[model samples]
Target: MDTKRISYLYDRYQSNSLTALELEELGMLANSQEFDSHFEVVFNKIWEELKHEEVHKMGIEAEQAQVDFILSHPRPKTRRLKFIHKIVAAAAVLIVVFAAGLFYRSFQSAQTMQPAYAIVPGKQGATLTLASGKQIKLSDASKGKLANEAGIEIIKSADGSLIYQIKDAGTGTSGMFNTLTTAKGETYQVRLPDGTVVQLNADSKLSYATSLNAAGERRVELIGEGYFDVAKDKAHPFIVKTATQQIQVLGTHFNINAYADENVTRTTLLEGSVKVFSAGTQKMLVPGEQASTRENQLSISKADLESAVAWKNGEFVFTGQPIDEIMRLLSRWYNVEVEFKGPPTKEEFEGTAFKEKDITEVLELLELTGAVHFKIEGRKIIVTK
Candidate 1:
């Protein structure tokens, strides 16, 4: 309960070295009657010092190795462990599960329902910088031009989307570098110079080289959600990169839900072909097939394209989906916190609703199935019997 023990457990948690027994004990202490309130106070203070940004770059194996080590080696009980250690140990366990998957129930149950995890959607907007280091923030401004950057005019449409075109130059090979970011609850569509139409979902960012090079393939890094309708370039393949997975495609229309908070990176193909690779695993998805990767494992199944892309079309659709999974989807898009008040039920729902529907209405529909109930306080949804 003191700082010393907190430091020890914090170190072990960061390094992924806490044993299963220690982790369970830590979980208990976090939600225990004696220390629940003060635990959060000490845990947050120490967490700021121990946070690491470099962990995202490592492969899935490294994460698993850490988890495996913890489960294999049990540490001895130490009265020396601090109270702060116990609180943070609880948070660290949830973080591990999130990186290892997308969601976990125990952590969800421990928190009071609030919109702690919800985020607002990002609209179509960007800042373009010219070669001269001058910047332009696009809106309905400057004739939708991002200024002439290296002789390529960076243009934004009325919809706040971006595109690049050569200006006052022969078939010269010149382009401008730009980045696109989407906030929570928003989505945008863009046609790349290569004719690839990319639909970026909320809380996602993408950056591409300004000029398309005469190269082996085209590559782009993704930090959130996006749907790709790639223009077929037989000589050049399109590659989508995430923190832990890579998706390669020729010409295809597919949606990728790979939010950093999600436990799995899902690639659902509507047409053409996509090959998903992670660590030592590879799975090729054909039209109507979907591939999902979690903790370095692969799963592929026949998919309903309409259901996969309902969000892009401004709707929510679930067909015989489990309650836990449905909560995951709602948590991200609605940007609300979820707390389970009891043991998870044997309940699942089949329904559809427009994204434009009031959050309460959607919850009402779920309640009709007689499986669950929801409480809304501001942006939070508390799950109850």
Candidate 2:
């Protein structure tokens, strides 16, 4: 495998100017394990030309797409290579280089037509409102005890996570509640008094009693999305209330997506059991099951756990999700407004992207599918066919 030839084919493919013969040749070369070392050298050279900042903007989805394209290339039926399995195994390592080459080419092209505005990804932060109506901006608050309410002491850890430490367990009920809210482009995690941990996604809120055991049962009202890890206390069950549904559990790990813009409230159980109540209907969900509630109707299905908690894990994992839904998510995380300029392209996107990438890079990854396009003007993202 000639490194120069490999580089030429890669450049042509990136420019969409590769001929049929060249495409086949490139595919064959990419399919061979013997040429993997040569591909690495060529790609490394290309990667060197990318600016340091641009290299950081590259995304995993783009790399995965390149790998998929290379692997899907038709093999020569008449010839069987003994190292075919080895080539398949090495594709992941090699394709990263190929993807970097693609990103470098894309970065060069982007420079010629850069958008007027760039939207950075979301960050870990939220606002904590105490029972007395005092609001503490967690993002700006120092790393130490922020407040003391009733018997709970609110502390901000070194890593920025909010913590509620019990000062006097017997001090009990104060008939007061505290709320934690994350605005657009922000997220947060908090450890409650009862040892339960709650992670709030962007554009979400969680309100709970200052003392978890004060009400006899641990109760919390949630808006938008949250991942809950309830502490076990058989005497006092954990309960989460959303707009359309209520989930009661002894001690469980689960996620609830109850955005008002969405039609249904989804409760996905990752561990233990939960009973979802909606209107007058109720359904018990086991692990790996999801309960969706809308009005008086409630249904259950196998849950996509990874997708359910992707935000909490700092990634966006879309599996055949529509363009509108994807943009809705992007709007929340990037703190941007989305407007569709034409009839929506019915394209379904499937990929995993890090939430840290700039909106431009994410949009570019989606555009690679040739299904949708985006334009940024100030804080607005205009979608087009």
Candidate 3:
């Protein structure tokens, strides 16, 4: 039967009015990726219809539910349509996994996964640009007052963290700004004037005013990824400004991934609450929720918190990422060049690897999956199918 016919049969099944013959016919389509995707859309609508809650988890449960309900057919003494193939039901039920598991499928295809040379991983160190334009290499700079900007003392702690203290509150200019930046293969941690701790990922920047505004708002602009543990100030809300979105919070722990190259800017909240807004959309996120902003629209969804914060805690949660997206992240964190011989691997991958491990070790894990192969030459990685 044509896809339209299959779709019609599936619709009837979803509405709880399908015959056993149609059920077997539709089950055969489960092995088809295109058909599965179509079924995913159909089941998403059914989940919404269920009205138990938003279809936040994987969408497979709905598919399995239909199968289970059909198998539990209770009408006795009724002439049942005999199925031609019993295996169809089992295969269809197994295919009912949700999108959350999209990138985590069992690997079906394999290739060599080796790299030419190892690249050093990024570490906790960044450069600080004071309001006076004086540069301090935070990695090499010793503890103590590194510089002063607008009356705020820029202190480099012995522990390699940067801090801004209002040494002479009445003497410093309140509106001046300072910037903290991490280069490729680097990271940084800093405390703002109000004691908010920020953890910056590789190739990121954070710019903020040295003092809170008189209007009672703590504002900072982010250009890459950063995790924020905001200090409580009910009277002064903390706002993280990105190019296309703004996240406002009273006191919360959140992570913002606002890389310029990414089409969607993501804000994942881990603690308390946060409000994300753009041109015409706004969303308030609770713990374990994430907001993705693209093209002036903001969408909310349940997030894999462990994956979202993995980098901040020194690991990479490689789940369902294609070769291209995977290389881009490695390029930033390891400061290396990457080229692909063919189209990037579209398969999803999973594993937890340390960020501090040699880049080769990380690539080894990817190779073990047989998803793709990597060859490095003079710091350049060539990806092959």
lDDT of each: 0.63, 0.80, 0.73
* Ranking 2 against 3 by TM-score, winner: 2
lDDT of 2 at 310: 91
Position 192, candidate 1: lDDT: 70
Please give the lDDT score for candidate 3. 0.73
CA lDDT, candidate 3, residue 284: 86
Preferred candidate (lDDT higher): 1 or 2: 2
Rank list by lDDT: 2, 3, 1
Superposed on all Cα atoms, model 1 deviates from the true structure by an RMSD in Å of 19.2
Off by over 4 Å in 3: 1-118
Better of 1 and 3 by lDDT: 3
What are the per-residue Cα lDDT tens digits for candidate 2 across 54-147? 4335554565465576557742222111111232323343454354444333333334324675678999999999999999999999999999
Residue 359, candidate 3: alpha-carbon lDDT = 80
Q: For model 3, where is the 10-residue window of minimal lDDT? A: 102-111
Per-model TM values vs. the true structure: 0.60, 0.75, 0.69
Model 2 regions lying over 4 Å from their true place: 1-113
Model 3, range 144-214, lDDT digits (tens) per residue?
98887666778888788888787766665546678899998999999888889999999999998777553
Angstrom error at residue 18, model 2: 21
